[model samples]
Target chain A: MAAGEVSSLEDCLEEHLPPAVLQHVWRMLYGKDTRKLDLPKSALTASLEKDFQLKGFGFEAAIEQLRQPRVVRVGLIQNKILLPTDSPVSEQVAALQKRIADIVEVAAMCGVNIVCLQEAWTMPFAFCTREKLPWTEFAESAEDGQTTRFCQELARKYNLVIVSPILERDEFHGDTLWNTAVVISNSGKVLGKTRKNHIPRVGDFNESTYYMEGNTGHKVFQTQFGRIAVNICFGRHHPLNWLMYSINGAEIIFNPCATVGALSEPMWPIEARNAAIANHCFTCGINRVGTEHFKNEFTSADGQKAHHEFGHFYGSSYVAAPDGSRTPGLSRIEDGLLVAELDLNLCRQINDKWAFKMTGRYELYADELAEAVQPNFDPYIVTE
Target chain B: MAAGEVSSLEDCLEEHLPPAVLQHVWRMLYGKDTRKLDLPKSALTASLEKDFQLKGFGFEAAIEQLRQPRVVRVGLIQNKILLPTDSPVSEQVAALQKRIADIVEVAAMCGVNIVCLQEAWTMPFAFCTREKLPWTEFAESAEDGQTTRFCQELARKYNLVIVSPILERDEFHGDTLWNTAVVISNSGKVLGKTRKNHIPRVGDFNESTYYMEGNTGHKVFQTQFGRIAVNICFGRHHPLNWLMYSINGAEIIFNPCATVGALSEPMWPIEARNAAIANHCFTCGINRVGTEHFKNEFTSADGQKAHHEFGHFYGSSYVAAPDGSRTPGLSRIEDGLLVAELDLNLCRQINDKWAFKMTGRYELYADELAEAVQPNFDPYIVTE
Candidate 1:
């Protein structure tokens, strides 16, 4: 790291917070790259790098004679909402569209095949504000939403598969709102959508006030690049969320989240990396950057006074390979894009070495969990 | 970190090895304590600290007037086999017993309620050598094994619940051998055994050559201090292995492991820590330290030449809390003990905050795994 960066990080250490509350502080002190998988920067990327923090890595695998290497470049983009919460919904959408389009163009120049945006990238993270009027207006149809149309145009122009997580207004049965990810193919066609299964009611994440838990099962979309799945935001905390996606033949799972430093920064580095090792699949953790301030004040119900600003949305986006090696994260305080080139063959290679699936003994766990769910179930507790 | 330690760690980075092969090298560069939960060194522990690297931390929790705090001080012991592999079996057992006895005495003085030793603590990790004669001689009955008998006396004397991982020779059932952890209660009675469910076939872990998969299910023993379970060695890699123990009502799980650096150092820090977070339980990862050379050389079937020593054991024992915070590890090259004082109430506190159990949706996964085990079952794969 540069001397200036070290001095800035040292400033964060002087905040005088308790250790548990500042769990991610000590790691920020190092301010050095943990792994060295440097991706060569091109002229196009270099020009855009000045606008935002753009960094990348490549996951290398051994050569196999019979099987050709499946090299898929995945780009994770984390950005801030440019407008305030009280701004017009269309204006907010337009600002994010333009900002993300520039980053996607840079990713295309850097040869990113699949691109993923941070959770609910179309509007401000206003759920914490607990206001339904201006916030719910941002929700759009998943099939042909304004965000989807924008991503579709970019996907076709750049010849890239784009994953757009947005607030969905489902119009089929009822006008029910949902947290969903729309997968647009390189051909500009809407492939399908996966809803966020788990919902959070903790702290300032009053997400349950807007939408209930999703109905969609763990779904993997097979694109030309790779088999991908999305575990949105709070779902990353649940290991089974990652496992079910892997069981469904997803080689790459993306955790597009909008969590803050106080709530989940310490867990951010660990969950995705651990998922990669346990599931024998590549994992991408993309968190939204910058603090989003709302028009109304919010209280977390934890004895703290009401405040207008939500905690800092730590933007340490990075990728973890199937072998448990991970790339260094983007800046915590800056909008950034992390591009990772992964060899799909590493998934099977790690599986062969670890034999996790073969030795997983799914049958035993099936029986155990089955027995556990019973109304009069007895836990296998051996008490003296 | 001291200047001497930093210089020594820097020296290890100079050894030429590919990035993938030396995954743990970068973390060693920062030899500073990652978390600050320092336990005060008592004079009793200070005397024994001179013999080996002894370090500890304490887990603090919120105060509740309705419920009394259940603080359990747990000690993890990791040590190398003091004698050569070719040494007399009786002499080897005697040496290890005396060394472990001294460590347990220190733990008693430090007010540890439970103590756990590394896997196959009384024997050299001989399974890697794929030899049978001298190693098989080390196996004894779990109920009355020489190692268990020794631990029984220590438990009675110190009033400590001891978990001893040993090679169990089930003489009553065709003299079958199994990797088992015999849990001795605080009163010194044998409290049954939990075997290593997942046997590894990767690298030099030729465990299947000695015994088949364990028959004993994931068992959590409700001792006086805490409800504890043992997920021995290779079982750490499987998330379900940890889940079953938690579902069985374990507040703390001890992973008594015997792993080498090259094969698992990168994964060692992650698996146990992830388990603690996912299961809402305190986890102790205890690994044997130092390299044990065998009399005969063995080949790992990976085109490598025959070798006398299984790679460095890489002790690095640590304790992880349910809140995702972990203590700095013990030395990578020294026999050490990690004592952690944990309030069992923190497990429930984390569970309430995360609501992992309520939101886990176990019934869905149970059915998914049940379908997965069928011969004609189709995996939930989506293809273009």
Candidate 2:
């Protein structure tokens, strides 16, 4: 991080909060990633160790030794709605930019190397209204947009790998639009980008009304800190989506999402953890907080023009380890940052232990899925 | 159900359990299946409805209306190890046979239409030993195996659809071995078999040393109750395995596994539930109970000749609905039966609302996965 940026961050901190409270908040968020602050052995881990003991010949000691050192600190920022639904896109983007800048300084001070923002973090989740005119204003060029430029400055200032998810307008490609996550490197470089591959058509997400699913095959962005992948939002529900990212050798994958409690809370707690376990990697699931009420009533599946507030955005974000244990909800109703010191080496350790990828029988499944994706594929072969 | 089978089941109940206790046990396991029982609104159902509201236009009421009829009673049996590890395969087989028969009688009295056994239920999970001779003794022909034949009679006697997972030997095909599940219909005939495609190579499971991964593409068995699929044991770790089963129209997919708490307990609770939500199906994840102590010390990755048991086969079996809500753990230690009344129509209802499968962009994923399965595929197009 540059001296100028560090001073600016400190200056902002000094101006915005009291020294005592700022110190406490920074410690609260960055405390674990500081490398000096050791976390207590989780009960789940002790139970797993004791219960799955390799006894008689005493191999449990070896398993314990394997779990030490080699950690990567990742920070997940689940932001709340930063502006009202009717705010101008420029003002909305500016407000979120300032908020995230403050967060990035705090996250960097906390020693977080990687920080991820929620999906479409700059503007209100106004897609629930099914109105086109105003929300379209939020879409900007992913490469040169003001939002990406703002993130670049933060990335450079914090020496952080920032995953900034936004509604993108591809001006070079026929003005095409996409749900994209721009990966900004520590050197203020745009490393690459990943688009949301699976789009939802059900309920409040008539996302097809805005943009189609992405064309990028499963992609992993190779960064200096770690190899990372982005499975934006609805893609989390697709197991294959998660599998493909793992197959691409991602040690840490972030799911930047904007889902409501009523829309997918039951599945919210299940999919990311399972993907982390099954794929032998660390997964951070981040969702935005608060509710967005629509002014206009829209016709929906219930055959009525009805007004509805978008379901509550639960924002209970957490990080899951390769071994399947996850952090409890960080903040269910408030904006918060969740950080963890992940031993990136744990990915290899768990993979070596589980060998899920090696034993995954990709060839067999590939053949089956190859046939399955055919236009006339049959789901069942019934024999009388 | 056939009159003879009903009468025999009644006779067994009359001969063994008293009327009051039997009724209580029946209600405990099978109450949800009996439409007349009028279950109090289930916490799982109420939670799911509350968490995944179809908002905007009040269509959740219609979804509730859709969930009214169309229920299937399925039973999951996570049996405890019934014999010593060093015991003769025949003795072990007989011991489990009697135990399973007793359990099946209880399951029938409980009104379970479909009952599934744990993976290779007739014998010990001795694959961890990496020794062939004794474990090979457990292998039998899938078509005429003693285990299948045993289950055949039980299925006929109970008028039950029995899914019997076993170590299969194809005698006619050069005695090739497979981890297989044989689906026996209510009439006591072998419907078909689905082989476990994904084989484990990590930890205690060097399954490839005994049997290669199965070549059979995903197949669903159409039965009197509903379409079913079996993803035997290690296949549970692969999400694509579960997805293929769902795409093949499996309403109830049974994951009969032998995973221990040490190796995958954290994952056990998460995977099947997520698979249920992602695939829009009912999933039963069953594991064996008790410690299967090995007579010989096996060499494991921990660099020691270990006389370790294959960890505790934590029998925390449960059922997950399509919308991702799940039943509580049946038993973590003792052998028990978990029965759930699945509204099979919920698969379509959830799919209709989520439209995940319908809008999954199978064509695009198929093209990518087809390329991905090639011998020389790479996940990144790296650039400087």
Candidate 3:
């Protein structure tokens, strides 16, 4: 339960269980994470050793289609801050950019039409420190931030849609701060940006100390590849967040998150997959991989002692399809790029089979939610 | 994929895989289904060889509590039709009642405070046959029906609460037929009823043809043991159905289902478990076992050939706690009783830890849903 650890008991059990048994269990439990996509090795991929792990898989659907399958290749990147928390912010940003550029190049080689980075990928996840001077320096304008510029160049060069999540400094609204995702189209133009609607107050997140909830509504971006929406980090916990994106005609929803293992590992697999099933859309769940340490000690209200580091950010990023099938996830201990090819037509096909939209009865729920939110609302409990 | 079969490929794989590997895969994929609850062997349990499978597990939680833990023992029964689908309606009902009596007796002996049976437990699942004669004959009045009266006597004798999901014949309302769960209190009184809100239209489930949407809102019944709600059958597919029960102060939600494997096997685990996580409540997912053969052929919208029976109803009943842990599921091919002891205190404790209620922003979602339900509503999509 300590910081920088991913379940002491699980570690102990992993050591005791046979390797074949562990593999069998995970394969049975998670299904085939993904059938290994045998991509011909490129110069960039072959040159890099274990430093940058690149994985690819495909989610095939069996729905009847009149038109040709609209297969869109998507990439998700989970990486650690290359520099220490005490390192210079500029140096940290530069190191992350260089590492990400290498991975994105590999994704492009593997024909990824769209790609996304982890939440706040440009800098260390240093909100746990609650320090204003140093961490606040990482925030920049989403319109033309250094990170946005870098992603734009890659997106245009590779002809890929890029979703870049960042710490935003909104100067127009009296210099407000927000957690935002900057969507860049394949043509290198800045498509509209969407902010994280939900903020976390639990654990050592201390995100509420930095910024309030986002003002932007749920916005799905229309790109040449597909209609995509980003549900950043903590918003994955709310089913309504996912539902709104689906209601807005989003074909694929990306959840770029920064969460540790002890707090959320058990829930990591279930939530996004459930969202994909409920919404009849594709969902990509991406997480930061390594433990993030702060120069200052922090304490969570869970009675744990004050610690200088958040627990390990277990990276098990994967893609879930509309048909209730998912690709295997990336490694929990490594920085990896998970590339998945999806047929966009599967979205409508799943809806055709399940009829979630037709059977949902959205009007009744709208009334129920409206009534429940009333000040004098009484829960419909049958006391009799 | 044939009627009365679970999965052809899964069966083939099971034949090939070593038993140890299969066990490892199941244990790994499902985690520990449940640590075996060593109950003192009873006469009824001892007498039944493999006819009745009795299983139990305990879900323990760790949280700061001021009051003593409120431990409630719950029992879920997944059963098979005791008679052939074409049998006399009265004989079919009598045969099922005799079988249920034995199961309820075992549950009472296991100290079950509240028990729930699978959907339409007293009759064969003949809805797929789309025949109105024998199936309609099985429908009875909720108040003085033969099934409700039988449950009332058992409830009073054992001082237990029972949830009987039955095909209800509403005598006053034009002899309307509906899928209802009659809540029988410990004193053998009818504690009102809640109907299945969502009806399935896919696969071989011809539910919408038989009944319309339930008039009863998501009703949480306050019993002596705990506040409970029944989201019968297809309601599990809708996240809002589960949320309304939680919003109405339900501590435990029972999903009594009669679905086939080909249609919903992949979804069986994810939906209810995700509900328990999203709602911060305990969810018991119960499914009917075995396949019922009909004299007439049935054809679904799917391209499969006409069949005499619906596909297998793979029974994998299990309990999911507020925390992300779940007990192992029951058998897929057997009639079984899964009893789990839960501390109701875990409900609020999870809410305290996750604060899902506080951060959920229900008002925002209420407005979003309201706008979405409007006839001329425009989705909040970003095209620029």
iRMSD per prediction, in order:
7.8, 13.3, 4.8
DockQ for each model = 0.38, 0.26, 0.46
What's model 1's lDDT at B342?
89
* Ranking according to TM-score, highest score first: 3, 1, 2
Off by over 4 Å in 3: A1-36, A47-50, A63-65, B1-36, B47-50, B63-65
Per-residue lDDT tens digits of candidate 1, residues B64-92? Answer: 88999999999999887888889999999
| Model 1 misplacement above 4 A | A1-50, B1-50
For each candidate in turn, the TM-score is 0.91, 0.82, 0.93
Q: Would you list the clashing residue pairs of candidate 3? A: A4-A311, A29-B29, A33-A327, A33-A328, A34-A328, B33-B327, B33-B328, B34-B328
lDDT of 3 at A131: 80
Per-residue lDDT over B1-384 for candidate 2, one digit per residue giving the tens place of the 0 to 100 score: 011111112223334455655443233222222222222344224323322110000001123653465657787887776667788878989998887887676667556789999998888888888889888888988888788888899999999999999889999889888899889999999998888888888778778888888877788888888889998888888888898889888988999988865567657767787888889888988888777888888777766666657777767677777766666565455667666777687788888878778767766666666677788987763321
TM-score of 2: 0.82
Q: Give per-residue lDDT, candidate 3, residue A261.
A: 70
Please state what fraction of the native interface contacts candidate 2 reproduces. 0.49
For candidate 1, write residues A1-384 as lDDT tens digits: 111222112223333334543332222222112334455467245536547877767778889999999999999998888887678889888988988888888888888999999999998888998889888998999899888898999999999999999999998958999999999999999988899989988788989899988777888888999899999988888888898899889999999999976677667777888899989999999998887777778888889899988888878887887776777778777778788888999999999998898888888889988998889988777766
Ranking by DockQ: 3, 1, 2
Task: Tell me candidate 2's TM-score on chain B.
Answer: 0.82
